[model samples]
Target: MSVAATLSPAADVRADFPGMVTGDGAPWHYLDTAATAQKPQAVIDAMTRALGVDYATVHRGVYGRSAQMTLGYEAARRRVAEFIGAKGEDEVIFVRGATEAINLVAASWGMAQIGEGDRIVLSMLEHHSNIVPWQMVAERTGAQIDVCPLTEDGRIDLGALEAMMTPRTRLVALAHVSNVLGSVLDARAAADIAHSVGAKLLLDGCQAAPRMALDMAALGCDFYALSGHKLYGPTGIGVLWAREEILGAMPPWQGGGAMIDRVTFEKTTYAPPPQRFEAGTPIITEAIALHAAIDYVAALGPDRLLAHEAGLARQLRDELRALNSVTLFGPEESAGIVSFAIEGVHPHDLGTILDEENVAIRAGHHCAQPLMDHLGVPATARASFGLYSDENDIAALLRGIERTQRIFG
Candidate 1:
């Protein structure tokens, strides 16, 4: 049962995204989607409208436009709630990005819950965002950090994770999908393992949320984080979703304007839950654009996006494997990300060559230097697919790789 045989492509979607073309209207073969996604015209239009005609600060002014902007901003939160299957908008706290989201959880929740001798578990495949925040928190709180090993095939080893869990384990933070390898985590299993020892699970959903249909309850994770840019929306807005009670209990990480119930020189009272965490001026235009992006993705079908990209991943892997000069990474069945190293070519060299062919690929450690070390490679050339990626992009990549191989020889 091959992934390609079982899955279909998110067909004919490239046209909706304006960035798919170059200055001369030639196709731009974008394969760096795991880093960030290209925005659809719908999202751009929504953002343009929001920043122009509907521009107003939220939750402050008694003016009519301010009230409407506030309504639109809150509506965006509800839309994310609907998209991710959170209990309500109260569970979603918008931040700068997934980086900030994780840092907030680490500072607010980790500071309070984790203490001396408490263990915080993370995996080898974590993005620096996930790894660094926990490290900062652990250092401050005197918490011990435990690194969970990955399976031979690159997936997070849940069996090993379960065995590692102890009563002292206060938190287990892992990626829902590997940003480098495209290895999808069995989040429910991880969540169960974390909870078995009375620890909370935080899933970095930056890679998963765009492709997979997310349900906070179904996943059983205590917290989930995702970025708007990766979800085909604007930057400067991301989400941190926690169980309603957990978010309510977690103290505000930052303090300022809108988050306060009332502020006095003598004493300051804070707002509740999401509002308390949001602090000052929120991501107004970005949130509204995110709402539009969610609508665009929903219209395409979230579950189907995974299937489509997985098929492409299988297709690319098969083609790259045939080259024999290419050393592929990750499992055979992965989401729409393929990483490999050429026998004699540096990833950066290959990337530059591909650029001349009007093809774009990510060539670096991808901010996962630990995973790069584990894989015994300095870095890899990664081709990550989005809803707009298609066979044409793959063909262009293969052509560029062949040219690189010839030049290297």
Candidate 2:
């Protein structure tokens, strides 16, 4: 309730990112942080150093530089463990992104545990990455998926989720926070409901990881996945955090050089959990840069970032409500993201005009086509904030929206 009050006096961290300015030296209002956050100078510098001077393959060579690179790579895993409050680095597996992380889980864990008549539970607002992978696993294994509906305010309805629970449920996967509506899930309650029915819980944490403080053990989730790019780091590197016991039991989905322990004509053996999940040459520079990104986020405090961005969402919602021509989506209280539709103007048209004002926003189904259908809309104009975002970004967005309305008028 006091989010806006707390953020009014917060320091501006926009200077940390060079991407906040346009090519013409104007302030570029980036309102698409939910898609991918702009990188800080610290993260950029770390990646440049690793890619240029310290570049080397990991877990293979016994030479000095390779040894150092391997240490850094593994250290990045430890840093991630610390950031998310995991039990250990062994519980973390590096994948391409949250997309690949979900695929890895579906292919390895879901395929192994799920069978005919088994069920998987998902929310209505899941991203395409989350939905499609589970669908593939379900199709292959003869398992079924159940979608939990949202409340009137667009939050994942926990009451409906509890009613959907049954002994037949194998896994309950949901977004920790919705990318479109910015609806924050009650992850603890969902985790409890899933476990009550002897089902494992997997959270797609791409949106929550940047906006909220995460404690893996505290959350009581069986698996958690997030993307580095959305966390203000480089792409192609993400983390899949599972309870060590669960990860140990799941078989390897990908086969390659580094994941193998010993390979022969007769049979082959795989490495331990983390290394087993990460096959071949891993993301070297990306992992190191992710460490820097986590450091930056931790210093700023994820709780503070959540409050700050939520404050901006509140402000944007209030302003948009004052405009009778606009229709807003999502709850009044949300993370940083805001989604709305202007009467007589397509979101694509509004986004194009906003781009002219150095304001960027996502204007589509936001990879949640099912949710779009549920809302009875083709697309929406979304302005999502980051740690660097402030009132200035929201002001620019409003200016562009007003301009769009006038043109339509």
Candidate 2 residue runs with Cα over 4 Å from true position: 1-11
Off by over 4 Å in 1: 1-11
Model 2 TM-score, all chains together: 0.98
Residue-wise C-alpha lDDT for candidate 1, range 71-121, written one tens digit per residue: 999999999999999999899999999999999999999999999999999
Q: Estimate each model's TM-score.
A: 0.98, 0.98
- In terms of lDDT, the poorest run of 10 residues in model 1 is 1-10
lDDT of model 2, residue 94 = 93
